[model samples]
Target: MASSLRLLLPLLLLLICSIHGGRGQPCSTSDIRVEQRTTGASVEGQPEYQVTVSNTCDCPQSKVMLLCYGLNSVTDVDPRAIKPVDAKLCAVAGGRPLSKGTPVKFKYAWKTPQDFPVVSSEIHC
Candidate 1:
């Protein structure tokens, strides 16, 4: 019985890690969250919003792409931070890794708040 437990333990651990992206924690594109709030500031007579993009995964998220079609900001967004890939996508962090818990922040001004949804990301454990 003890021998069975010893063999089973490692198998269980391997299964768990595989299910959790090998970092002892779950990782997915959903782990990327974008939060925005009005900064109580205005640019070009439009309300400005402070946007924070954070990774909740235990591993680093790289090549994060966001849905950015029709996104225009009176407050200039830094191209190096995020730039338009095409008509419907934007690359975040210049296609670099976003460390866990460290957020990428930016500001944009528009008549209405825009939603930046995570389209895809590669998790680096």
Candidate 2:
């Protein structure tokens, strides 16, 4: 019994370590830029901005969701006025990932409610 217990103890510990080992080289893309556009202005209050989220990377890419916020404009409104947006993968060019550093994009339109302060927008992944 003592001999079997000793063997089992080391095996259990080794099993735990392997399970916790770090996973390497996740599918990663370069930092993206938010291309903002004002589609139709409001007669009053803050104007609506349409954000086009994009990924500009040189590899096969996939959409990654991130936290986004507005800055320097309104203090009383939500920092991340909009929900998390997903990064898009670039389409294939001749059966390959889009050109190196080309962007894959998605559009998100939102309006800053009256009295909400915001100057610039940002996203955190």
Candidate 3:
């Protein structure tokens, strides 16, 4: 019984330390830009430009996904129907996980169908 207790003590301590040390990290976005322009002589014109969203975290993320949504400033456009390639490109920058302070770039070419109300975007991982 004494020998068994000694071996189990170290294993228990390691298990407790690993469990306490494990955590989920948060990823943040920064430097969002939107440029709008008129397409010919139409009242509703989609903007054409690429907005880059970067991951600013120390931990690596899995299954990262990016998406765009319509704002209240534009009523003629619906974001649900807008695919990344139609004007924007929703793609995986790379297969490897993003490192600390490293940015995952996403190129988007979309028209808001109106003026841009918000100058920021978001991502999920």
Every model's TM-score: 0.83, 0.31, 0.33
Indicate the worst ten consecutive residues by lDDT in candidate 2.
114-123
Q: Which order, best to worst by TM-score?
A: 1, 3, 2
Top-scoring candidate (lDDT): 1
Q: Highest TM-score: which candidate?
A: 1
TM-score, candidate number 1? 0.83
Q: Which segments of model 1 are wrong by more than 4 Å?
A: 5-26
Point out where model 3 deviates above 4 Å: 1-46, 68-91, 113-125
- Clash totals for all candidate models: 0, 5, 4
From the highest lDDT down, the ranking of the candidates is 1, 3, 2
Cα lDDT, all candidates:
0.87, 0.37, 0.38
Deviation from native of the Cα of residue 31 in model 1, angstroms: 0.6
Cα lDDT tens digits for candidate 2, 1-125:
99999999988877655543322222243334446666575433556544444444323433333334322232232223233222322221122233335643333333552211222222221
In candidate 1, which residue pairs get closer than 3 Å at backbone N, Cα or C atoms, i.e. clash?
none
